[model samples]
Target: MRNDPLLSIKGLRVEFPTQDGPLVAVNNVDLDVARGEVLGIVGESGSGKTVLGLSAMGLIDRPGRLTAGQVVFDGQDVTKYSESGWRNIRGNRIAMIFQDPTTSLNPVQQIGAQMIEALQSHRDISRDNARQIIRNAMVRVGINSPDERLNAYPHQFSGGMRQRVVIAIALLNEPDLIIADEPTTALDVTIQAQILRDMRRLSRDTRTSLVWVTHDLGVVAQIAQRVAVMYAGRIVENGPTEKILKSPCHPYTEGLIASMPANALPGERLHSIPGGLPQLSKLPAGCSFAPRCNYAASACNMSPKLIQISSDHAVRCVSPLDGGS
Candidate 1:
């Protein structure tokens, strides 16, 4: 059913062993991506948005490890999947589209070769069939002359076109889940808008679930059906997109909304949240955000569990803001 979650992450914690100690990149995070749902994971840099996405895909390696929790994909406990086991899922059942295509694509290979390789890796398909699939995906992502573009190298395309090529590859398999980590960051405003439109259209037509990780609330407003607000390595708030945008309860979320260019008054100084993010290895004792939170009270001297505020909204604050503007 459309209401069913395609992926569920419970009590997730990701840690990296540092010289000082284990740096907790993600702390007790619980999240879900419903079938064909476009869920936005939004926060400032180093708030663990990317780490949580990678961990959900079982891509966290070595010093960075999943210290706790489970990542369930399509009812399977993917957290327990071995490297070899992950191969059957990664790029096949689940695909990730990175920000920069230049870094993700091979400079030396033709686009068609790369796309064909990706298809053949998971599916028992001939090169001719794979080429047709690749061409179709490229067209779906709005790439002009998809057949000719397949012969061109990554360098032959512009920044926007390169990203489209990456999207093409991701969609070639028609994966169940697509983890797009800031996929629009490298494009200009005009190009960014166009790409986002194309992605939304394709997501709807294909019924592919998307976990779009970004710091841009504007983008979230346009693409996401639900939003998760991460702060200091944990989800401080999450709910339907309109609710999160209009009536953010978490102070950090309120600050982020206040800092938006659209939210600022003309000729007035822009709003900003005071203080820097705490270093995970040496986070203060108590709530991680208590140091910077203006409304923090005595009860905030300890971590607060996520509390249900409504059927579709939840917040993690002992003193949440009351539908702040």
Candidate 2:
């Protein structure tokens, strides 16, 4: 971890009021993203990855409250920020690229106009200057003939091009941090690769921190410097991407890696973890993953806390696969 992280999340908890009860979408989670670092958050659907990202952006809406914890960005605790305060920080200091580009873009507005509006919204710039910036940003994302393309509406662009426009808009203000919530999941493999490469390059060039949320470990391996494996609203393991991929400590992390298609042998069946995620309101007494863990023991019945296994690696397990006890 860096001495001064760009974003720090401590004991964060997000809950939603449901008919049954208050469902804890994000359990007590702590994370840090250093400047120019790419931290990948990996988990199954409903594992609270998206909620965690939204919490970082201060975007949790009505009924879904940030019940606990502090989200510190650049040493300032933003949980205390009001809506107006968040407005200044949102597009100006931090930006988010969501999963769907269509929903993020305005169908009726020209792409150039939208991009120019995004830039001018955060910065006091002239229309001509903003348009130039938009054109440069579009070209940076590999959008050809940016000047001509700018006049086209979102519907006129292909799925990949729309996503590129979204990325361009997110980077227009040059925010310090970017939270991408599976932004490439909807694209084809080729498009996904291009986007990932561009994002990684952009982060490195700008020294901007990134938190990428996705269910695909392959994506994490390609782009993330560090990996956090989340399960049942908690981080089961976190460490350098190479270490997490090569020597996963948590059973859930191991299972996730094993289930990857790249790890499967030709003609052999793909591996899968048994059982599904537990209901947050009705989680087991101890570890949430104990029910599905093949190595689960009686000790697992007692909830475990995240413990350091090395200088950087951490895992929440009674018996970590790394031989920790």
Candidate 3:
């Protein structure tokens, strides 16, 4: 059906073997992303957002493994895909744009060479045809003189420009889904805005599903249609962007929203959630966030299941703010 989600992750549990024991990075996480939709996963560092994205792309490497879950893409289960199987689906059906283009791209290779290799790896197109596609993609991403730029090495470009090239490579394959893990975080405010705008336009034009992972709420406001707040290896809250931003239910979500720079008045002291993220390996017996929660009640001593507050809004908290249902 046309209504089916483009990607679905159910009961995803990714773990790593540590001396302490199995360190769970993502625990029973569930998410759905429809075609042409922009879903943002926001959380502090080590909250498992990056791990979850890698798992979705079948890129989880040694020491880290998906213990249980189903990753269905376009009606096919890719959770159990072999290495070769992933090779076909990775760049062809789903692509990834990492946080740092400087490291993701090779310094010795020319930009054109890398782009051509990426294209030819997944598609059977000739080098000449791939060159044309890469040129057009660079132009679409707002790079001037794409032909000349393509011939240059990654070091020749500026930080923002290199990121643009990375974006271009992700779009070159016209993949159905793109997982961008904080692609704009390394850039300045102006460059961040420009890159986000280009990506938004391109994804909409191509009807590609996007999963944007970041810790910046401002970035999510600019690009995401829906937002998921992750904490200590689990999603504590998720809902439409507008509702989640304006009426956060969970204490963690409330803290995140309150801490945004835009919410503060002139010269007013900024609000911040007390305490740091708890260690995942030694998480509390109840909710992981209960230690820092301002409104923790007696019921919070026990973990609460994700409860639906509305048709599309859910929060994993025993005592949600504003008397949420």
Q: Which candidate is the best by TM-score?
A: 1
Clashes found in each candidate (C-alpha, N, C closer than 3 A)? 0, 0, 0
Q: Residue 46: error of model 2 in Å? A: 0.7
All candidates' TM-scores? 0.98, 0.97, 0.97
Return whichever of 1 and 2 wins on lDDT.
2
Where is model 2 more than 4 Å wrong at Cα? 1-3, 323-325
Q: Candidate 2 on 111-212: residue-level lDDT in tens?
A: 888888888777899999998888888888889899889899999998999999999998899899999999999999999999999998998888888999
- The digit string of per-residue lDDT tens for model 3 on 1-325 reads 3899999999999999999888999999989999999999999999999999999999999989999989999999998889999999887789999999999999999999999999999879998899899989999999988888877999999999999999888888899999999999999999999999998997788889999999999899899999999999999998998888888898898888788778999789889999998888888988889889888877888988888888999999987777333
Model 1 / residue 10 / CA error / Å = 0.6
For each candidate in turn, give its C-alpha RMSD to the true structure in angstroms.
1.1, 1.7, 1.4
lDDT against the true structure, each candidate: 0.91, 0.92, 0.91
Model 1 residue 234 lDDT score: 94
Best by lDDT: 2
Candidate 1: where is the Cα deviation over 4 Å?
Answer: none
